[model samples]
Target: MSIMTQLEFELEFSQSEKQIAKYILNHGEEVLSMSVKELAKETYTSPATIVRLCKKIGLEGYNDFKIKYSAELQYDLHHTDRIDVNFPFSKDDSYPMICHKLSSLYQEVIADTIKLIDFTELNKIVDLLYPHQHIDIYGSGNSLLAAMSFQHKMMRISRDVNLRILHGEQVFMSYNSNSSRIAMIISYSGETNENIQIAQTLKENNTPIIVLTSVGDNRLSHYADYILNIGSREKIFTKIAPFASQISIEYLFNVIFSCIFQKDYEQNIQNKISYDKKNDFRHPLSSPVSDEIK
Candidate 1:
Protein backbone atom coordinates (compact mmCIF):
# COMPACT_ATOMS: atom_id res chain seq x y z
CA MET A 1 0.00 0.00 0.00
CA SER A 2 1.15 3.55 -0.63
CA ILE A 3 1.76 5.91 2.29
CA MET A 4 -1.20 7.98 1.22
CA THR A 5 -3.37 4.87 1.38
CA GLN A 6 -2.16 4.16 4.89
CA LEU A 7 -3.02 7.65 6.00
CA GLU A 8 -6.53 7.29 4.61
CA PHE A 9 -7.06 4.05 6.52
CA GLU A 10 -6.44 5.66 9.88
CA LEU A 11 -9.82 5.27 11.47
CA GLU A 12 -8.34 3.49 14.48
CA PHE A 13 -5.31 5.72 14.86
CA SER A 14 -4.46 7.45 18.17
CA GLN A 15 -4.43 11.20 18.51
CA SER A 16 -0.62 11.39 18.31
CA GLU A 17 -0.63 8.98 15.37
CA LYS A 18 -3.23 11.06 13.58
CA GLN A 19 -1.17 14.18 14.18
CA ILE A 20 1.93 12.53 12.75
CA ALA A 21 -0.08 11.24 9.81
CA LYS A 22 -1.48 14.69 9.08
CA TYR A 23 1.99 16.23 9.02
CA ILE A 24 3.45 13.49 6.90
CA LEU A 25 0.57 13.69 4.44
CA ASN A 26 1.03 17.45 4.08
CA HIS A 27 4.82 17.30 3.86
CA GLY A 28 5.64 13.79 2.66
CA GLU A 29 8.59 15.00 0.63
CA GLU A 30 9.91 16.94 3.60
CA VAL A 31 9.42 13.94 5.85
CA LEU A 32 11.90 12.03 3.71
CA SER A 33 14.76 14.20 4.95
CA MET A 34 13.71 14.26 8.61
CA SER A 35 14.98 11.83 11.22
CA VAL A 36 12.69 10.03 13.67
CA LYS A 37 13.62 12.44 16.41
CA GLU A 38 12.88 15.37 14.14
CA LEU A 39 9.44 14.01 13.20
CA ALA A 40 8.69 13.22 16.86
CA LYS A 41 9.68 16.76 17.84
CA GLU A 42 7.64 18.30 15.02
CA THR A 43 4.57 16.22 15.82
CA TYR A 44 5.25 16.87 19.52
CA THR A 45 5.42 13.15 20.24
CA SER A 46 8.15 10.78 21.38
CA PRO A 47 10.41 8.93 18.93
CA ALA A 48 9.00 5.61 20.17
CA THR A 49 5.51 6.85 19.42
CA ILE A 50 6.55 7.69 15.86
CA VAL A 51 8.03 4.24 15.34
CA ARG A 52 4.90 2.66 16.75
CA LEU A 53 2.78 4.72 14.40
CA CYS A 54 4.88 3.53 11.45
CA LYS A 55 4.48 -0.09 12.52
CA LYS A 56 0.73 0.36 12.93
CA ILE A 57 0.52 1.37 9.34
CA GLY A 58 2.51 -1.77 8.27
CA LEU A 59 5.93 -0.15 7.99
CA GLU A 60 8.82 -1.77 9.88
CA GLY A 61 10.02 1.44 11.48
CA TYR A 62 10.43 5.15 10.95
CA ASN A 63 13.34 4.63 8.55
CA ASP A 64 11.43 2.05 6.56
CA PHE A 65 8.44 4.38 6.45
CA LYS A 66 10.61 7.21 5.23
CA ILE A 67 12.13 5.02 2.52
CA LYS A 68 8.70 4.02 1.17
CA TYR A 69 7.38 7.58 1.34
CA SER A 70 10.51 9.02 -0.28
CA ALA A 71 10.43 6.52 -3.13
CA GLU A 72 6.74 7.14 -3.92
CA LEU A 73 7.22 10.90 -3.56
CA GLN A 74 10.18 10.80 -5.93
CA TYR A 75 8.17 8.82 -8.47
CA ASP A 76 5.25 11.28 -8.29
CA LEU A 77 7.58 14.28 -8.49
CA HIS A 78 9.42 12.95 -11.52
CA HIS A 79 6.56 11.38 -13.45
CA THR A 80 3.30 13.27 -12.78
CA ASP A 81 4.47 16.90 -13.36
CA ARG A 82 2.89 17.79 -10.00
CA ILE A 83 -0.81 17.80 -10.91
CA ASP A 84 -2.77 18.31 -7.70
CA VAL A 85 -6.01 16.35 -7.69
CA ASN A 86 -7.50 18.79 -5.17
CA PHE A 87 -6.77 21.76 -7.43
CA PRO A 88 -6.22 20.26 -10.85
CA PHE A 89 -6.51 23.54 -12.74
CA SER A 90 -7.22 27.20 -11.98
CA LYS A 91 -9.42 29.67 -13.85
CA ASP A 92 -6.41 31.83 -14.66
CA ASP A 93 -4.51 28.87 -16.12
CA SER A 94 -3.78 28.90 -19.85
CA TYR A 95 -4.94 26.23 -22.24
CA PRO A 96 -1.52 24.60 -22.40
CA MET A 97 -1.25 24.51 -18.63
CA ILE A 98 -4.71 22.98 -18.28
CA CYS A 99 -3.81 20.37 -20.86
CA HIS A 100 -0.60 19.55 -19.07
CA LYS A 101 -2.31 19.27 -15.68
CA LEU A 102 -5.14 17.09 -16.95
CA SER A 103 -2.72 14.87 -18.82
CA SER A 104 -0.53 14.52 -15.76
CA LEU A 105 -3.55 13.77 -13.57
CA TYR A 106 -4.60 10.91 -15.83
CA GLN A 107 -1.08 9.48 -15.88
CA GLU A 108 -0.77 9.69 -12.11
CA VAL A 109 -4.16 8.06 -11.47
CA ILE A 110 -3.38 5.18 -13.83
CA ALA A 111 0.13 4.80 -12.42
CA ASP A 112 -1.17 4.62 -8.85
CA THR A 113 -3.84 2.13 -9.94
CA ILE A 114 -1.25 -0.07 -11.60
CA LYS A 115 0.75 -0.15 -8.40
CA LEU A 116 -2.28 -1.48 -6.46
CA ILE A 117 -3.44 -4.12 -8.93
CA ASP A 118 -2.94 -7.77 -8.01
CA PHE A 119 -2.13 -9.60 -11.22
CA THR A 120 -3.08 -12.99 -9.83
CA GLU A 121 -6.55 -11.86 -8.77
CA LEU A 122 -6.97 -9.94 -12.01
CA ASN A 123 -6.22 -13.04 -14.08
CA LYS A 124 -8.75 -14.99 -12.06
CA ILE A 125 -11.45 -12.42 -12.82
CA VAL A 126 -10.47 -12.46 -16.50
CA ASP A 127 -10.85 -16.20 -16.58
CA LEU A 128 -14.35 -15.85 -15.18
CA LEU A 129 -15.23 -13.30 -17.89
CA TYR A 130 -14.99 -15.90 -20.64
CA PRO A 131 -17.59 -15.80 -23.39
CA HIS A 132 -19.64 -18.61 -21.86
CA GLN A 133 -20.21 -16.74 -18.60
CA HIS A 134 -22.84 -13.99 -18.28
CA ILE A 135 -21.58 -10.82 -16.59
CA ASP A 136 -23.98 -8.51 -14.69
CA ILE A 137 -22.41 -5.22 -13.68
CA TYR A 138 -24.07 -3.00 -11.07
CA GLY A 139 -23.20 0.55 -10.05
CA SER A 140 -24.74 3.94 -9.30
CA GLY A 141 -24.06 7.36 -10.78
CA ASN A 142 -20.59 7.78 -12.27
CA SER A 143 -19.74 4.21 -11.37
CA LEU A 144 -22.71 3.16 -13.48
CA LEU A 145 -21.22 5.16 -16.34
CA ALA A 146 -18.02 3.19 -16.02
CA ALA A 147 -20.02 -0.03 -16.05
CA MET A 148 -21.72 1.11 -19.28
CA SER A 149 -18.32 1.66 -20.83
CA PHE A 150 -17.31 -1.88 -19.92
CA GLN A 151 -20.62 -3.18 -21.25
CA HIS A 152 -19.91 -1.50 -24.58
CA LYS A 153 -16.45 -3.03 -24.77
CA MET A 154 -17.79 -6.48 -23.97
CA MET A 155 -20.46 -6.06 -26.64
CA ARG A 156 -17.84 -5.30 -29.29
CA ILE A 157 -16.22 -8.67 -28.53
CA SER A 158 -19.60 -10.49 -28.32
CA ARG A 159 -19.45 -11.27 -24.61
CA ASP A 160 -22.65 -11.50 -22.59
CA VAL A 161 -22.94 -8.50 -20.24
CA ASN A 162 -25.77 -6.64 -18.50
CA LEU A 163 -25.30 -3.16 -17.09
CA ARG A 164 -27.71 -2.24 -14.27
CA ILE A 165 -27.64 1.44 -13.39
CA LEU A 166 -30.86 1.65 -11.40
CA HIS A 167 -31.39 0.04 -8.00
CA GLY A 168 -34.54 -1.80 -9.06
CA GLU A 169 -32.92 -3.01 -12.28
CA GLN A 170 -29.86 -4.23 -10.38
CA VAL A 171 -31.97 -6.14 -7.87
CA PHE A 172 -34.09 -7.63 -10.63
CA MET A 173 -31.04 -8.65 -12.59
CA SER A 174 -29.38 -10.18 -9.55
CA TYR A 175 -32.52 -12.10 -8.62
CA ASN A 176 -32.83 -13.61 -12.07
CA SER A 177 -29.12 -14.25 -12.59
CA ASN A 178 -28.02 -17.85 -12.12
CA SER A 179 -25.03 -19.29 -10.31
CA SER A 180 -23.11 -19.46 -13.59
CA ARG A 181 -23.34 -15.71 -13.95
CA ILE A 182 -20.70 -13.30 -12.61
CA ALA A 183 -21.21 -9.89 -10.98
CA MET A 184 -18.89 -6.91 -11.06
CA ILE A 185 -19.53 -3.91 -8.86
CA ILE A 186 -17.80 -0.56 -9.40
CA SER A 187 -17.93 1.85 -6.45
CA TYR A 188 -15.06 3.97 -5.15
CA SER A 189 -16.53 4.34 -1.65
CA GLY A 190 -17.68 0.72 -1.56
CA GLU A 191 -20.37 1.87 0.86
CA THR A 192 -23.30 2.22 -1.51
CA ASN A 193 -26.09 0.37 0.24
CA GLU A 194 -27.97 -0.49 -2.91
CA ASN A 195 -24.86 -1.81 -4.63
CA ILE A 196 -24.08 -3.85 -1.55
CA GLN A 197 -27.62 -5.21 -1.54
CA ILE A 198 -27.23 -6.31 -5.13
CA ALA A 199 -23.97 -7.98 -4.27
CA GLN A 200 -25.62 -9.79 -1.37
CA THR A 201 -28.48 -10.98 -3.54
CA LEU A 202 -26.02 -12.23 -6.12
CA LYS A 203 -24.02 -13.97 -3.45
CA GLU A 204 -27.11 -15.71 -2.13
CA ASN A 205 -27.82 -16.86 -5.69
CA ASN A 206 -24.26 -18.27 -5.79
CA THR A 207 -23.06 -15.75 -8.34
CA PRO A 208 -19.39 -14.90 -8.26
CA ILE A 209 -18.62 -11.22 -7.66
CA ILE A 210 -15.62 -9.04 -8.43
CA VAL A 211 -15.46 -5.62 -6.82
CA LEU A 212 -13.45 -2.60 -7.94
CA THR A 213 -13.08 -0.15 -5.08
CA SER A 214 -10.61 2.22 -3.45
CA VAL A 215 -7.78 0.87 -1.30
CA GLY A 216 -8.68 -0.42 2.20
CA ASP A 217 -11.34 -2.91 3.15
CA ASN A 218 -15.00 -1.93 3.38
CA ARG A 219 -18.39 -3.57 3.86
CA LEU A 220 -18.59 -4.43 0.15
CA SER A 221 -15.22 -6.15 0.09
CA HIS A 222 -16.40 -8.74 2.58
CA TYR A 223 -18.81 -10.36 0.13
CA ALA A 224 -16.71 -10.14 -3.03
CA ASP A 225 -15.39 -13.33 -4.52
CA TYR A 226 -12.53 -11.25 -5.83
CA ILE A 227 -11.58 -7.71 -4.79
CA LEU A 228 -9.69 -5.14 -6.79
CA ASN A 229 -8.56 -1.82 -5.36
CA ILE A 230 -7.97 1.53 -7.07
CA GLY A 231 -5.91 4.57 -6.08
CA SER A 232 -7.89 7.48 -4.58
CA ARG A 233 -6.36 10.55 -2.98
CA GLU A 234 -8.94 13.14 -3.83
CA LYS A 235 -10.25 15.26 -0.92
CA ILE A 236 -13.86 15.98 0.10
CA PHE A 237 -13.63 19.49 -1.37
CA THR A 238 -12.56 18.00 -4.68
CA LYS A 239 -15.85 16.09 -4.86
CA ILE A 240 -16.67 18.40 -7.75
CA ALA A 241 -15.55 15.39 -9.73
CA PRO A 242 -14.68 11.86 -8.76
CA PHE A 243 -12.03 12.19 -11.43
CA ALA A 244 -9.11 10.29 -9.95
CA SER A 245 -11.14 7.37 -8.62
CA GLN A 246 -13.16 7.06 -11.81
CA ILE A 247 -10.04 7.07 -13.96
CA SER A 248 -8.45 4.50 -11.72
CA ILE A 249 -11.49 2.23 -11.93
CA GLU A 250 -11.68 2.59 -15.69
CA TYR A 251 -7.98 1.91 -16.10
CA LEU A 252 -8.21 -1.33 -14.14
CA PHE A 253 -11.34 -2.35 -16.01
CA ASN A 254 -9.50 -1.76 -19.29
CA VAL A 255 -6.73 -4.04 -18.15
CA ILE A 256 -9.23 -6.78 -17.33
CA PHE A 257 -11.04 -6.29 -20.64
CA SER A 258 -7.77 -6.49 -22.56
CA CYS A 259 -6.92 -9.72 -20.81
CA ILE A 260 -10.28 -11.21 -21.74
CA PHE A 261 -9.97 -9.89 -25.30
CA GLN A 262 -6.60 -11.59 -25.75
CA LYS A 263 -7.85 -14.90 -24.46
CA ASP A 264 -10.05 -15.27 -27.56
CA TYR A 265 -8.27 -12.87 -29.87
CA GLU A 266 -8.43 -14.96 -33.05
CA GLN A 267 -12.04 -15.99 -32.53
CA ASN A 268 -13.04 -12.44 -31.60
CA ILE A 269 -11.43 -11.09 -34.79
CA GLN A 270 -13.27 -13.63 -36.91
CA ASN A 271 -16.56 -12.79 -35.17
CA LYS A 272 -16.03 -9.08 -35.86
CA ILE A 273 -15.28 -9.79 -39.48
CA SER A 274 -18.46 -11.87 -39.86
CA TYR A 275 -20.50 -9.23 -38.01
CA ASP A 276 -19.29 -6.44 -40.26
CA LYS A 277 -20.12 -8.45 -43.37
CA LYS A 278 -23.58 -9.32 -42.05
CA ASN A 279 -24.29 -5.66 -41.17
CA ASP A 280 -23.00 -4.21 -44.41
CA PHE A 281 -26.52 -3.86 -45.83
CA ARG A 282 -27.47 -1.62 -42.91
CA HIS A 283 -25.05 1.04 -44.16
CA PRO A 284 -26.18 1.64 -47.74
CA LEU A 285 -23.66 3.11 -50.15
CA SER A 286 -24.92 5.65 -52.71
CA SER A 287 -24.28 4.97 -56.37
CA PRO A 288 -22.03 7.29 -58.40
CA VAL A 289 -24.99 8.31 -60.65
CA SER A 290 -27.10 9.25 -57.59
CA ASP A 291 -24.21 11.24 -56.13
CA GLU A 292 -23.77 13.11 -59.45
CA ILE A 293 -27.54 13.96 -59.57
CA LYS A 294 -27.33 15.23 -56.00
Candidate 2:
Protein backbone atom coordinates (compact mmCIF):
# COMPACT_ATOMS: atom_id res chain seq x y z
CA MET A 1 0.00 0.00 0.00
CA SER A 2 1.09 3.58 -0.60
CA ILE A 3 2.05 5.92 2.24
CA MET A 4 -1.09 7.96 1.56
CA THR A 5 -3.17 4.81 1.98
CA GLN A 6 -1.55 4.26 5.34
CA LEU A 7 -2.48 7.83 6.22
CA GLU A 8 -6.10 6.93 5.63
CA PHE A 9 -5.72 4.03 8.05
CA GLU A 10 -4.86 6.39 10.93
CA LEU A 11 -8.51 7.15 11.56
CA GLU A 12 -7.91 7.87 15.23
CA PHE A 13 -4.94 10.25 15.09
CA SER A 14 -5.19 13.26 17.41
CA GLN A 15 -6.16 16.71 16.17
CA SER A 16 -2.63 17.85 16.97
CA GLU A 17 -1.23 15.38 14.43
CA LYS A 18 -3.65 16.72 11.83
CA GLN A 19 -2.51 20.24 12.67
CA ILE A 20 1.11 19.14 12.31
CA ALA A 21 0.25 17.59 8.93
CA LYS A 22 -1.50 20.76 7.79
CA TYR A 23 1.50 22.85 8.80
CA ILE A 24 3.91 20.52 6.99
CA LEU A 25 1.88 20.53 3.77
CA ASN A 26 1.88 24.29 3.87
CA HIS A 27 5.57 24.48 4.69
CA GLY A 28 7.38 21.23 3.91
CA GLU A 29 10.78 22.62 2.93
CA GLU A 30 11.09 24.72 6.12
CA VAL A 31 10.21 21.88 8.51
CA LEU A 32 12.23 19.24 6.65
CA SER A 33 15.41 20.95 7.88
CA MET A 34 14.27 21.30 11.50
CA SER A 35 15.35 18.73 14.10
CA VAL A 36 12.66 16.62 15.75
CA LYS A 37 12.91 18.76 18.89
CA GLU A 38 12.57 22.00 16.96
CA LEU A 39 9.68 20.65 14.87
CA ALA A 40 7.87 19.54 18.03
CA LYS A 41 8.29 23.01 19.58
CA GLU A 42 6.94 24.61 16.40
CA THR A 43 4.08 22.16 15.98
CA TYR A 44 3.51 21.76 19.76
CA THR A 45 3.77 17.99 19.35
CA SER A 46 6.15 15.59 21.07
CA PRO A 47 9.46 14.42 19.51
CA ALA A 48 8.10 10.87 19.40
CA THR A 49 5.19 12.13 17.27
CA ILE A 50 7.66 14.01 15.04
CA VAL A 51 9.39 10.73 14.25
CA ARG A 52 6.02 9.18 13.49
CA LEU A 53 5.22 12.13 11.25
CA CYS A 54 8.49 11.59 9.41
CA LYS A 55 7.44 8.04 8.72
CA LYS A 56 3.98 9.28 7.77
CA ILE A 57 5.59 11.53 5.15
CA GLY A 58 7.18 8.43 3.59
CA LEU A 59 10.58 8.90 5.15
CA GLU A 60 12.95 6.52 6.96
CA GLY A 61 13.97 9.08 9.58
CA TYR A 62 14.26 12.80 10.18
CA ASN A 63 17.95 13.09 9.32
CA ASP A 64 17.69 11.03 6.12
CA PHE A 65 14.47 12.75 4.98
CA LYS A 66 15.77 16.25 5.76
CA ILE A 67 18.97 15.64 3.81
CA LYS A 68 17.05 14.47 0.73
CA TYR A 69 14.51 17.31 0.95
CA SER A 70 17.29 19.89 1.41
CA ALA A 71 19.08 18.47 -1.64
CA GLU A 72 15.86 18.52 -3.69
CA LEU A 73 15.19 22.13 -2.71
CA GLN A 74 18.70 23.04 -3.90
CA TYR A 75 18.75 20.71 -6.94
CA ASP A 76 15.48 20.14 -8.89
CA LEU A 77 13.69 23.30 -7.80
CA HIS A 78 10.20 23.67 -9.31
CA HIS A 79 7.64 26.47 -9.66
CA THR A 80 5.65 27.09 -6.51
CA ASP A 81 2.03 26.02 -6.20
CA ARG A 82 -0.42 28.88 -5.52
CA ILE A 83 -1.34 28.59 -1.89
CA ASP A 84 -5.10 29.01 -1.48
CA VAL A 85 -5.50 32.41 0.10
CA ASN A 86 -8.85 31.35 1.49
CA PHE A 87 -6.94 29.07 3.83
CA PRO A 88 -5.62 31.94 5.92
CA PHE A 89 -2.24 31.09 7.39
CA SER A 90 -2.89 32.79 10.75
CA LYS A 91 -6.63 32.31 11.16
CA ASP A 92 -6.47 29.20 13.34
CA ASP A 93 -4.32 28.39 16.39
CA SER A 94 -5.24 24.71 16.70
CA TYR A 95 -8.77 23.28 17.09
CA PRO A 96 -10.48 25.61 14.62
CA MET A 97 -7.88 24.60 12.07
CA ILE A 98 -9.01 21.02 12.39
CA CYS A 99 -12.59 22.01 11.56
CA HIS A 100 -11.49 24.10 8.57
CA LYS A 101 -9.28 21.29 7.34
CA LEU A 102 -12.09 18.74 7.67
CA SER A 103 -14.54 21.10 5.99
CA SER A 104 -12.20 21.57 3.05
CA LEU A 105 -11.65 17.85 2.78
CA TYR A 106 -15.41 17.13 2.89
CA GLN A 107 -16.05 19.59 0.07
CA GLU A 108 -13.26 18.09 -2.03
CA VAL A 109 -14.51 14.57 -1.44
CA ILE A 110 -18.06 15.55 -2.41
CA ALA A 111 -16.80 17.09 -5.63
CA ASP A 112 -14.47 14.24 -6.68
CA THR A 113 -16.84 11.58 -5.36
CA ILE A 114 -19.52 12.85 -7.75
CA LYS A 115 -17.37 13.01 -10.93
CA LEU A 116 -17.58 9.24 -11.49
CA ILE A 117 -20.58 8.32 -9.36
CA ASP A 118 -22.08 5.75 -11.72
CA PHE A 119 -25.54 4.82 -10.55
CA THR A 120 -25.44 1.96 -13.03
CA GLU A 121 -22.43 0.42 -11.31
CA LEU A 122 -23.85 1.10 -7.85
CA ASN A 123 -27.14 -0.57 -8.82
CA LYS A 124 -25.22 -3.54 -10.11
CA ILE A 125 -23.54 -3.96 -6.71
CA VAL A 126 -26.92 -3.63 -5.05
CA ASP A 127 -28.21 -6.40 -7.28
CA LEU A 128 -25.31 -8.64 -6.42
CA LEU A 129 -25.90 -8.17 -2.69
CA TYR A 130 -29.70 -7.86 -2.72
CA PRO A 131 -30.84 -11.46 -2.93
CA HIS A 132 -27.80 -13.21 -1.54
CA GLN A 133 -28.30 -15.36 1.53
CA HIS A 134 -24.86 -14.32 2.80
CA ILE A 135 -22.48 -11.48 1.93
CA ASP A 136 -18.77 -11.64 2.65
CA ILE A 137 -16.59 -8.50 2.84
CA TYR A 138 -12.80 -8.59 2.50
CA GLY A 139 -10.22 -5.83 2.87
CA SER A 140 -6.62 -6.01 3.90
CA GLY A 141 -4.05 -3.56 5.23
CA ASN A 142 -5.54 -0.10 5.71
CA SER A 143 -8.90 -0.96 4.21
CA LEU A 144 -9.59 -3.71 6.73
CA LEU A 145 -11.30 -1.15 8.98
CA ALA A 146 -13.64 -0.14 6.17
CA ALA A 147 -14.43 -3.78 5.46
CA MET A 148 -15.31 -4.40 9.10
CA SER A 149 -17.41 -1.23 9.33
CA PHE A 150 -19.44 -2.17 6.25
CA GLN A 151 -19.98 -5.66 7.62
CA HIS A 152 -21.32 -4.10 10.82
CA LYS A 153 -23.95 -2.09 8.93
CA MET A 154 -24.95 -4.91 6.59
CA MET A 155 -25.17 -7.37 9.46
CA ARG A 156 -27.94 -5.21 10.95
CA ILE A 157 -30.06 -6.26 7.97
CA SER A 158 -28.30 -9.47 7.05
CA ARG A 159 -28.00 -12.41 9.42
CA ASP A 160 -25.05 -13.80 7.44
CA VAL A 161 -22.45 -11.13 6.70
CA ASN A 162 -18.91 -12.48 6.68
CA LEU A 163 -16.25 -9.97 7.59
CA ARG A 164 -12.73 -11.20 7.05
CA ILE A 165 -10.31 -8.77 8.70
CA LEU A 166 -7.57 -11.27 9.52
CA HIS A 167 -5.68 -11.89 6.30
CA GLY A 168 -4.40 -15.46 6.87
CA GLU A 169 -7.59 -16.74 8.47
CA GLN A 170 -9.71 -14.95 5.84
CA VAL A 171 -8.03 -16.82 3.02
CA PHE A 172 -8.57 -20.06 4.87
CA MET A 173 -12.23 -19.35 5.67
CA SER A 174 -13.16 -18.08 2.19
CA TYR A 175 -12.88 -21.50 0.55
CA ASN A 176 -15.32 -22.97 3.00
CA SER A 177 -18.01 -20.40 2.10
CA ASN A 178 -21.21 -21.84 0.68
CA SER A 179 -21.85 -21.39 -3.04
CA SER A 180 -24.90 -19.19 -2.35
CA ARG A 181 -22.84 -16.42 -0.76
CA ILE A 182 -21.57 -13.24 -2.48
CA ALA A 183 -18.22 -11.64 -1.70
CA MET A 184 -17.32 -7.97 -1.87
CA ILE A 185 -13.71 -6.86 -1.60
CA ILE A 186 -12.74 -3.36 -0.47
CA SER A 187 -9.41 -1.86 -1.53
CA TYR A 188 -8.63 1.79 -2.06
CA SER A 189 -5.71 0.94 -4.36
CA GLY A 190 -7.42 -2.05 -5.96
CA GLU A 191 -3.93 -3.56 -6.00
CA THR A 192 -3.53 -4.88 -2.45
CA ASN A 193 -1.88 -8.28 -2.83
CA GLU A 194 -4.18 -9.90 -0.32
CA ASN A 195 -7.30 -8.31 -1.78
CA ILE A 196 -6.31 -9.33 -5.31
CA GLN A 197 -5.60 -12.86 -4.18
CA ILE A 198 -8.93 -13.10 -2.39
CA ALA A 199 -10.75 -11.76 -5.46
CA GLN A 200 -8.93 -14.26 -7.65
CA THR A 201 -9.80 -17.11 -5.31
CA LEU A 202 -13.45 -16.08 -5.25
CA LYS A 203 -13.53 -15.69 -9.02
CA GLU A 204 -12.03 -19.13 -9.60
CA ASN A 205 -14.59 -20.70 -7.30
CA ASN A 206 -17.51 -19.09 -9.25
CA THR A 207 -18.56 -16.91 -6.29
CA PRO A 208 -19.85 -13.53 -7.39
CA ILE A 209 -17.29 -10.84 -6.58
CA ILE A 210 -18.00 -7.14 -6.05
CA VAL A 211 -15.09 -4.69 -5.85
CA LEU A 212 -15.19 -1.28 -4.17
CA THR A 213 -12.08 0.63 -5.05
CA SER A 214 -10.95 4.09 -6.15
CA VAL A 215 -9.63 3.11 -9.58
CA GLY A 216 -12.15 1.32 -11.77
CA ASP A 217 -9.57 -0.30 -14.01
CA ASN A 218 -7.57 -2.74 -11.87
CA ARG A 219 -6.89 -6.46 -11.69
CA LEU A 220 -9.36 -6.95 -8.83
CA SER A 221 -12.13 -5.18 -10.73
CA HIS A 222 -11.39 -7.35 -13.74
CA TYR A 223 -12.58 -10.36 -11.73
CA ALA A 224 -15.55 -8.60 -10.16
CA ASP A 225 -19.10 -8.76 -11.43
CA TYR A 226 -19.75 -5.33 -9.89
CA ILE A 227 -17.45 -2.34 -9.40
CA LEU A 228 -18.50 0.55 -7.15
CA ASN A 229 -15.81 3.17 -7.47
CA ILE A 230 -15.48 5.86 -4.78
CA GLY A 231 -13.60 9.18 -4.73
CA SER A 232 -10.90 9.75 -7.33
CA ARG A 233 -8.23 11.16 -5.06
CA GLU A 234 -5.04 12.70 -6.36
CA LYS A 235 -1.90 11.79 -4.44
CA ILE A 236 -0.96 14.29 -1.74
CA PHE A 237 2.74 14.37 -0.94
CA THR A 238 2.52 15.48 2.72
CA LYS A 239 0.24 12.66 3.85
CA ILE A 240 -3.19 11.48 2.80
CA ALA A 241 -5.79 10.27 5.25
CA PRO A 242 -8.81 8.40 3.93
CA PHE A 243 -11.29 10.35 6.09
CA ALA A 244 -13.08 11.70 3.03
CA SER A 245 -12.56 8.45 1.13
CA GLN A 246 -14.08 6.33 3.90
CA ILE A 247 -16.90 8.84 4.23
CA SER A 248 -17.66 8.40 0.55
CA ILE A 249 -17.70 4.59 0.90
CA GLU A 250 -19.94 4.77 3.95
CA TYR A 251 -22.21 7.16 2.04
CA LEU A 252 -22.41 4.63 -0.78
CA PHE A 253 -23.54 1.92 1.62
CA ASN A 254 -26.15 4.22 3.15
CA VAL A 255 -27.50 5.10 -0.28
CA ILE A 256 -27.66 1.43 -1.22
CA PHE A 257 -29.53 0.54 1.95
CA SER A 258 -31.90 3.47 1.48
CA CYS A 259 -32.71 2.31 -2.04
CA ILE A 260 -33.22 -1.27 -0.89
CA PHE A 261 -35.30 -0.19 2.08
CA GLN A 262 -37.43 2.03 -0.16
CA LYS A 263 -38.57 -1.05 -2.07
CA ASP A 264 -40.93 -1.91 0.77
CA TYR A 265 -41.02 1.35 2.68
CA GLU A 266 -44.60 1.01 3.88
CA GLN A 267 -44.19 -2.48 5.30
CA ASN A 268 -40.82 -1.57 6.77
CA ILE A 269 -42.35 1.41 8.55
CA GLN A 270 -45.21 -0.75 9.81
CA ASN A 271 -42.79 -3.35 11.08
CA LYS A 272 -40.82 -0.66 12.91
CA ILE A 273 -43.93 0.84 14.39
CA SER A 274 -45.19 -2.56 15.53
CA TYR A 275 -41.82 -3.42 17.05
CA ASP A 276 -41.67 -0.06 18.86
CA LYS A 277 -45.22 -0.56 20.15
CA LYS A 278 -44.31 -3.98 21.52
CA ASN A 279 -40.88 -3.04 22.86
CA ASP A 280 -41.55 0.61 23.89
CA PHE A 281 -38.57 1.66 21.78
CA ARG A 282 -40.37 4.78 20.57
CA HIS A 283 -39.65 7.96 22.47
CA PRO A 284 -42.35 10.45 23.32
CA LEU A 285 -41.68 13.78 21.69
CA SER A 286 -42.31 17.13 23.40
CA SER A 287 -44.71 17.84 20.51
CA PRO A 288 -46.93 14.79 20.30
CA VAL A 289 -49.25 13.68 17.51
CA SER A 290 -52.92 14.67 17.96
CA ASP A 291 -55.90 12.38 17.41
CA GLU A 292 -58.24 15.19 16.26
CA ILE A 293 -57.68 17.36 13.14
CA LYS A 294 -56.15 20.75 13.83
Tens digit per residue, CA lDDT, model 2, 1-294: 233333443434677767666666557578766778888898888888867765655578778657755754553254133222123224444877766766766666666566767888877767766777588777765566655666665554543677655448778666765568888777766666777777777877888877777753445667878777777443322333456557667666667666665666787676755655666534554436622222
Instruction: For candidate 1, report its TM-score.
Output: 0.69
lDDT of each: 0.78, 0.63
lDDT of 1 by residue, 70-131 (tens): 87777777756567776788889999988988898999888878888898998788877775
Model 2 regions lying over 4 Å from their true place: 1-93, 234-240, 273-294
Residue pair clashes in candidate 2: 8-242
Give candidate 1's root-mean-square deviation (CA, Å). Answer: 5.6
Count clashing pairs, candidate 2. 1
Candidate 2 Cα deviation (angstroms), residue 32? 26
Clashing residue pairs in candidate 1 (N, C-alpha, C atoms within 3 angstroms): none
- Which portions of model 1 miss their true places by more than 4 Å? 1-81, 277-294
Show the lowest summed lDDT stretch of 10 residues, model 2. 79-88
Candidate 1 — worst ten consecutive residues by lDDT sum?
Answer: 285-294
Highest-scoring model, TM-score: 1
